[model samples]
Target: MFLRAKVRKKDGKEHRYFSVVENRRIGPKQQKRMAQRTVLYLGEINDGQEAAWRKSLEVFDESCQRYSTLSLFPEDREIPAEASSSIQVKLSEMELRRPRMFGNCWLGCELWRQLGLQAFWEEKLSSQVQRETVPWEKVLRLLVVNRLIEPGSEFRLHRQWFDPTAMAELLETDFAVAEKDRLYRCLDRILEHKQALFVHLRQRWQDLFAAPFDVLLYDLTSTYIEGEGEQIPQARYGYSRDQRFDCKQVVIALVITPEGFPLAYEVMDGNTSDKTT
Candidate 1:
């Protein structure tokens, strides 16, 4: 890469404009060639110090090799340019925060966008109050992505997970959207459209995969509750999957496609058998 001075003869005056140019190599190794391209145009010589400008950019590029980012904003002309112009260039550095968590958040957000979950939530959520007050879809997607990457509860997400993550920058929103209660409320809103969401995702997956979603798969799981008769009737003692036969528990059945797209789910009594479910 190098700086180029373009000569412009306007009305018989020799005017020169500067541009940063780089050579791009393409094609097979045997047919490789350098193609010059303009990277940046530093228009006309307004200050008549084009030499100093070139020296500054060259020095800036050199500094990039040494430091990725500067810690704080500094006054212009902090570094002297040893060029043949009476121009003392001005430059300032801004501290850039690129958390390693950005890549994980970015992949999650892109997947959420590709699934059209954002648009779906915006359109399918039935409550007018929720649509106006909370970004139910965005929050829910964030929760899912965070769970996949970090595996934490809503409380952990709001209090700890949000702080070090690049979610704020990626979502272009502040801490209010990641509040604990707000994240939990997103679950309540989404459950209202659970069946519709499943159907929607199945169709979306079919379109994405470009194949028929054939073959149904069923799965059953059970979890026990530790509470002692807190007025919950469905909580019954059953053959515990975890061998906690004495504790109250509940059964859940999930129906999914061979492509791993969930179609429906059922929550049943604790003693419900796999055959009955």
Candidate 2:
């Protein structure tokens, strides 16, 4: 049994009451939590024992835990000039799971925040009624970050990559329930803002790096797709960077600063000549 105090201020005066509590389990059978079970309610303290009781109870409550943390200093050990002064260590009994690259997501999210991409999307993609738990902007950001870091398909992200990622928590949504079609729709929706995005990114790039645009380093590349799909209008027989000239491909034109920060890009038909694009 230990003392538990409750203090309330009423009309510029403090009223204090104490309780004798016992430890008990509260939550569900599978997820139990420690709670104080009140054994007796003691009236407001009018004596000196109140402070003493409070201090003792505080120590008792703190020590009633499952884990033990210890710090040790050896009396015979001498402090070496090159060695560290103190060594702090931690130990955990719980099994660690769901490991993901937190730093990668953090960097991606920070970049997005600095560029004001989230706010810009929210403003542009505003709707009359948003019933879904996750917003379109958030979904887009998740896909963008995933592409930048992991580089995978929507199916791969939804089925495999997303659950282990910090993206769900960072995007403020349940990613497991996020359908792949919604991601595709997000891609379609954001295409309308392509020009706007380029303009926004250009301003942010200049502001951040103060990079001069007097001269730009332009480049061209082509990615080959193995499947010959009837629906893909851009896919045609072209010179493939992957040495798969037999497969259909699409061409990409990129403009970057001397520092290699991309300022603009263009997607051309696979048959489009390098000089023509």
Candidate 3:
């Protein structure tokens, strides 16, 4: 890969933007053509930053059959580097900043997109006003991704996980998406779409993996909640799987394919019998 510069004129001034790019051949063998694909965007580097980047950048010397440090700028430019393309760095002075977890977060987002959930949620959770600061779709995506990667409470995600993961970069969103209030509010809004979401997921699973629907496994489980659960009518003293008979609990019924793909789930009153539900 190499650094490529793109020049744009705004207000009669020429501005340059830089990106790391690589060339690839595409199309069938007979109709193959070379194309440049951008790997990363480095917006508007000044002379000093350019010099620093050049000092650390490395390139492969095809003729010499070895890797060598080279300046990104042209030879005529006033940049600091050895004339022969060799440079030295004081490693001790360098410091890593804002290092965030990326791979799992990226995978989660990619899987979300692959399942067509991005468009699905965008349509279902669209903002009513033009100036809506909250990107509901992205907020929901963040919650789903967080749950998939490291299941945690919205509070933990807001206070800890969001900042440590690369969700912001992946979603093109900021910390606002992880705001505890917004996360909770988003949950309140999605219940209406539960059935639709299940339908969409089922269709996607079938389309992508050809998941079978002929045979389904159904099961029931109970989880107890602490406190009085005053606002939750479904929370009641019942058969607790955890043996927390003192605390209120709710029953969850799930139907899944033999291959372990969830088809549907329902949360019922703790006292609801599995036979009745």
Judge candidate 2 at residue 160 and give its lDDT.
Answer: 81
- What clash pairs does model 1 have? 77-90
lDDT of 2 by residue, 1-277 (tens): 4676899999999998887676778989999999877755877886587765554334212456642221122234454366465443232233567687778998998888888887889987877117655678888788888889989898898888887777777776685335788777777777778888888878888898897889999889988887885687888887778888889988989998899888888888998887876
Q: Kindly indicate the candidate among 2 and 3 with the higher lDDT.
A: 3
Compute the lDDT for candidate 2. 0.75
1-117: candidate 1 lDDT, tens digit per residue: 456788889998988887776667988999998887775687777554765655444434374565232211224545446534444322223354655478989999998889888
lDDT of each: 0.74, 0.75, 0.83
Preferred candidate (lDDT higher): 1 or 2: 2
Highest TM-score against the true fold, candidate:
3
* TM-score for predicted model 3 compared with the true structure: 0.69
Query: lDDT tens digits, residues 30-63, model 3?
Result: 9999998775689999988766665455666789
